[model samples]
Target: MKPVLIRLLLLLAWAPFYTQAQQRFSFEIEGGHFLKDGKAVPIISGEMHYPRIPHQYWRHRLEMLKAMGLNTVATYVFWNLHETEPGKWDFEGDKDLRRYIETAGELGLMVILRPGPYVCAEWEFGGYPWWLQNIPGMEIRRDNPEFLKCTKRYLDRLYEEVGDLLVTRGGPIIMVQAENEFGSYVAQRNDIPLEEHKRYNAAIRRQLADAGFDAPLFTSDGSWLFEGGTTPGALPTANGESNIENLKRVVDQYHGGKGPYMVAEFYPGWLSHWAEPFPNVSASWVARQTEKYLQNDVSFNFYMVHGGTNFGFTSGANYDKDHGIQPDMTSYDYDAPISEAGWVTPKYDSIRNVIGKYVDYVIPEVPAPNPVIEIPSIRLTGIADVLAFAKRQEPVESPVPLTFEQLRQGYGYVLYTRHFNQPLAGMLEIPGLRDYATVYVNGERVGELNRYYNRYSVFVEIPFDATLDILVENWGRINFGEEIVNNRKGIVGPVTVNGMELSDWFMYRLPMDGAPGPDKTAEVRAGTPEASFLHRKPVLYTGSFNLSETGDTFIDMSAWGKGIVFINGKNIGRYWQAGPQQTLYVPGVWLKKGENRIVIFEQLNDGPKNEISAVKVPILKELKS
Candidate 1:
């Protein structure tokens, strides 16, 4: 294999990361799916994100994926990960998307690029940059002149960096999506007009073509013939919504009535969140569809071959009660064949057997599984009894009002504070508080406004000569609804306290970047560990374990709360006490010859220096999430 280096740098914005780009790629598009240049490419693609998985395991994961007979790799371009602010973009470290695509090229695989200014990959803000929320009067995901205008600008900027990588242009990318599943949900037109949708779709295609991306631009839809289907120039394509028969209909419809088929989203698993029961997508005869497709010569991409971490507040959710309004959990362990900790789940072996039939080379042996951390349940005190550490710090600026986009932060809470110049009494109303809110009068907690129920306003009573504060926690934005998607965190509308509207001067910032580690002397509060309550939150816990041998171990995290895990300072991404993701993987490379330190930040449980043991990967029966 040639040496490959990838730079996630946003090109000319940040100093470039100096990683090798793969020297070559092989791709050929016939009726549709890309085949190796000289061969009839019966391609297999899997969806996973380099940013989602730990940076260190990119190659290991890719190698394993390829072994599964997946010749094509697909990933989403999380705009937030690149451009947190409008002009500033970071493609280095965890944000190194460029390196990822280029590396996939190096691995002799073709790639599908899902560069959505709004990719609803269960991401914090559906992959749209937070800055969009600050555009004043901006209507996102809609065809509003303002919305499309910004969309064009973002697309233009993005194309400038990777436009040349399209497959038609001889680059690794075979397909590029024009906004994920737009046809399946409420298009700006569905709520507005059909003409608007057509125009919006046309305009997007024009922009992509104008920017010279050259690759076929496809739209991913759960519904096949609604309008958008993938064939690009001919018709757009559709991924079956967890149903193989339906998937065939969509793919067949795209090929002018009949042909081989594929599912852009062959569900390897399902997504879940905090307040709900586990949303499980287990293996069964339906799960056999993956093997079935391969056996039948159909080309498809696993929506998420490897579900990675929704680290920080990057997880997303649907607002509709039918789908439940809770935000997604921090851990995105989609019950994929390849576990988030990077283990080869039993599901992996099952799919590999199904795919092994068509591959040219002998399937590479799956790497030995990582060690599992067999966490022994134990409880700790005093740490929970410690005093609040952040209340004493200067505290993040909160007197000035801010929006989720303005702060350049995504999912999570934002606080806005301002002292009332004159005192007045009436029903104070904040026409909107984005999603959720907690009101404080002179630093004393008063009450909170809840939006989990579709309420539009929060009424608070404020007094004279007092500093009124509104702490808005991001309960999660609406991922499955038709309303305000640009629905960011913080105060979304007018602010009124006690029937008196207060204007001018305010402060804001999530202060959720995380606190200054753990303190020996700190106090803890219950009922709000997962949300940012500042000082009342739990302190980080750190410990060391001696590995009798330096080997890969999946840190058994079944006993912990939601937060991140690190081995000897190497981040293994986010984890949750939630089942299905009870392990935070620690590759042997990050281990020490004797002892290794492991640090954890439990968002909920404040207990124990638990013991960990490596465990087996979990896959859906016929597939699992």
Candidate 2:
């Protein structure tokens, strides 16, 4: 025998011995059922994102899942969350993926790793780093070489961190997803050729294997998009509403009447976008689905067992066929079995009871609910003007309007100022106003252009020579649709005044992420002494209160128009009183006893009184759609 063949044969001879010594469990597919150590087993999994929840609460959430009769925990590893800036990966704090996986294993639960270069979980830029937008000839989630190179680099780093945790390496991770719902995505898009889509899937799978993932690779697609999204050699799984027969059909068709069917994303509850009421999938409906899967001996995973908060400007928007530019609210509390605040709900009981009937394993009692603190109302004073604060930011001069990425701005708002040379009047057209913009003449609010309403240009009547300011807020990038490619924020084209192209523009990038607090209030006052609430400029409201105890609470923003909030120097999330989500969730882990600080950067504060209140429970279901 050849030396290489002899060595390989010897390694294979010792494989079982080594695996046994390592206490490694064999997880694979046999016939049509998931088998563990050659015994048929069903995977009862629930989806959770570690970054969305506090690092301290991982175990608690895992325990909740386990108590609810889940044997596995599936999680999506967000690329953007880890690689926010190119070449700079952040796995510390809540972004730690290895720790999360190990914690699940320690809880006696298996894990299915869904590490996506593009995780379309209503996440900003669909989990692609915003910096990728500036790359030359970069096309995301497709067969672009530049995009694939960046993806490979990220995957290489990811595998280095958690690849050893796979089942073959004696870790609890049994399977690693090839990519998130790719078959469904490339199905209807004409921009990508079907052959190229298949090649891309094959390339990603090859890359994963090269990175040393020995476990089974799988692709998730909606039943309708199974043909296009499925990889030729990998396991194919379907996701959708409670329809077991349809799921089986999709799996069977993909596998050539083979077994081992799986539903990757079984939606117990749906995601709620801004302005739309929270989607409340009935507990009985969830129970019925859970029962059906258990009865049919089918392996399934809940889309969100615990949909946590989408902190900061990480929330995404959806461009629907019927509704245009629908932005997602910051509160990701998807009304799941485990609430965003880490508490169990009625759905928990329903699902637990249903699963208990089919399984012989005892389901533990649900843990006691955490104590919720009701904070008294906090009075906030308008401390500074945002434009006044903008003086510190070095302005970029441009003849035409610039996109946010063009000026190295990631999120939040941007200010485009132009000093009028002569008296100008008529329609001020920003042909490519990416989303929402507030038009101001000489610092006075005139009109607003909205992307959702398809209202772009606004009539500006400049009486005399005055400065024109268009403060644009990036509502959100479209997370899913054909509009994903053209989802650049700010102005992507020229700004015209009465059919005349305007030049000599002063662009100020307002990425108000880490704005200074009360100490910097003096700077704004010094910059614009005449700045007042009467003016339509952005306002930074500062307030501090003493907390006797720290617990989960919802900061009420029913009175506020639209803005983002910061508590104790940490960004809580954005809030808009447009009905659905009226409050932002404040995790107890973020708060401290004694003096606590809050700063609000209100884009449009409709105020007779600038104040905020906190309640004990989260307002999960929206009162209006």
Candidate 3:
């Protein structure tokens, strides 16, 4: 047998022995370090979100983290993914938090659970359920009574799922984080009293403790914002902080000058938004920081050692004083050590080398990359126009446009239409446009408005008795900053033309939660003529391709425009021609060895060609400057 093959075989045989079921162990913060069973242990950890990854590949990803010399795996429990609706909880399949933690424990890895009532992981509404907005007098991340009551209920339910997995209960969970980065939020909103922030933080901490999370608790924030975020009894940790001296000083300052310092979220690479260049961090630079952390005995967890994809409409946006609203791209690759497709980059080797020098145990061999395959071009034809379907829905008539939450809708598109009796021509303004919108007058495409660019108004010439339609899409809610609380989708305020408020409006909700199919009641033809399709409205294109063999592949949507893709009824994610990310990562597990269905919801595809290909590689950074 070949030497390489023999080595691999031996390693496989020894892996189980090395990762045998861990005995009951005690983990606590003591004397400036993490003490596991009375021994000081530096926590070499990395962040990986379970919902972002396919459940079938969870073990593979965990093993890859182990191979990188990480002893602990930290994950944020996104509340939105589990309890999507109020009182409607789901913990099975991909949303299984217990399975994820158990898989980590089985791999001889400790877990640090960040069960956030508010996680802010660039997720929709900062990991908040959309139903929260519908609650009467709801104010999140504050000392509001309604918010607290709902938060307690959600946390109580979460504890029921994985509370037994805590280290205190003889499981692998060593630490549980309190509210994520509360200090940053408090700092942003100066109008709120400091006492209210303190009360809210205390309430969240109490809720976690009361919910049976007996594991050592900690709160993470930027080095400068520790004052407002730190819980009284819990250990305080820094985020995005690399300077060992500053980190230690800040933690000490917050925790009464004591020790047990840790950097909860050390960044290897930064998050990328659509239309921007993919952020890249040097492997050597990260290695140097890793070396410093080890040399100083500072425990750290890479913010994302492996950032998976943001499937469906779960991606969030960010708003600032300078930048209005910047929506996150579909790919959450984050340029981490592990790629979104579960392949290790040079950064993985660099960090592993640094870790090997400090760790007592041997680092496992890097796991082999997942297999990939490519498919030939597949032609897709338009089946139904989204606008036509919207017209069929019974409209909600009101004097002004209502928000998505007011309409009992969550994420998707909403169409606001109005018919004018007189010919009014001027600038049409929708100042409360939540995200993105397309304007159409008399079945003709007029212009597009994007919230990312803060373009809310556009010129329009309306003929007498012409019908006007404004199709607004909730790209994503703001996950970070002070604007998060006020994130209401659709038109929240009045629609004006020539400084006059328009009244008597009709609205249709197009959640687009599932792939659009041809309406059976209507004479909707399956492959309609391209010229006959309404260019102003979104179109559903469908096609099927046979695959004798299935493997992981990237659906190349470069030929298409802005829209979402669904494979075999699974909503993979949204794609846009705005560059940065052009391909959607398709896991091999989602494919079969027979014919696989593909559907595309093309929003702005005015081009002639309507086809896509399944490529082996991803196109994450194709920015058009």
Estimate the overall C-alpha local distance difference test score of candidate 2.
0.81
RMSD of each: 6.9, 5.2, 6.8
Over the full model, what C-alpha lDDT does candidate 1 score relative to the true structure? 0.61
- Residue pairs in candidate 3 whose N, alpha carbon or C atoms collide under 3 angstroms: 32-260
TM agreement with the true structure for every prediction: 0.75, 0.93, 0.94
Candidates 2 and 3, the one with greater TM-score: 3
List residue ranges in candidate 2 displaced over 4 A: 1-24, 523-535, 620-625
TM-score of 2: 0.93
Clash counts for the predictions, in order:
55, 4, 1
Lowest summed lDDT window (length 10), candidate 3: 518-527
For TM-score, the strongest prediction is 3
Write the residue-wise lDDT of candidate 1 on 1-625 in tens digits: 3111133234433322212344444454565444565566665889998777756678878888887778889888877777766667666776766667766777777888887656788876677766676677777766677777777776776776676566654567877777677675544335567666656666677767776767756677766444632324533455755455776676666656654455677777777665445555565543487767766667778877888666555677666645435566656767777776676767777788777776776777777545544323312222332113323433445333566756666654555666666665556576566665656666555555655544444445566788766666675565544643646677766665554456664554433454334453354422245323433233455555565656555566665655565566555555544344455555566676676665555544444442445553432121012
Better of 1 and 3 by lDDT: 3
Per-residue lDDT of 1-625 in model 3, one digit per residue for the tens?
9543464466456544533455567899877779999999999999999999999999999999999999999999988888878878777888988889989998889999998888888899999998898889999888999999999998988877777678887789999999999999889988999999999999999999998888999999999998789989889999988888898888888787878879999999889898778999999999999999999988999989999999989999887778688889899999999999999899998999889999998889988988999987876644566677788889999998999998989998898999989998999998899989889998677888988788999999999999999989998999998888888999999899999999999999988788665442132334456435555456677778888988899999876778899998888998888878999999999999888888777787575445679899899989863
Per-residue CA lDDT of model 2 for 1-625, tens digit only, reads: 8543464466556545544544568898768878888888889999998988889888888999999999899998888888878887778889988789888887778899988776789888778788898999998778889989999998987887776678987878999898878866786586778988888888888788888887988888888887788886689988873677777877888887976878899888888877777788899888987888888878899989998989888888888777578888787778789988888789988998888888767877677665689887776644676766765678999877788999888898899988876788899888688788888888778887877777878888886678898889998787776677777899988888778888888988778787566666642331234445445666787877889889888998777777889988888888876757888888888889999888888777445444578998666555542
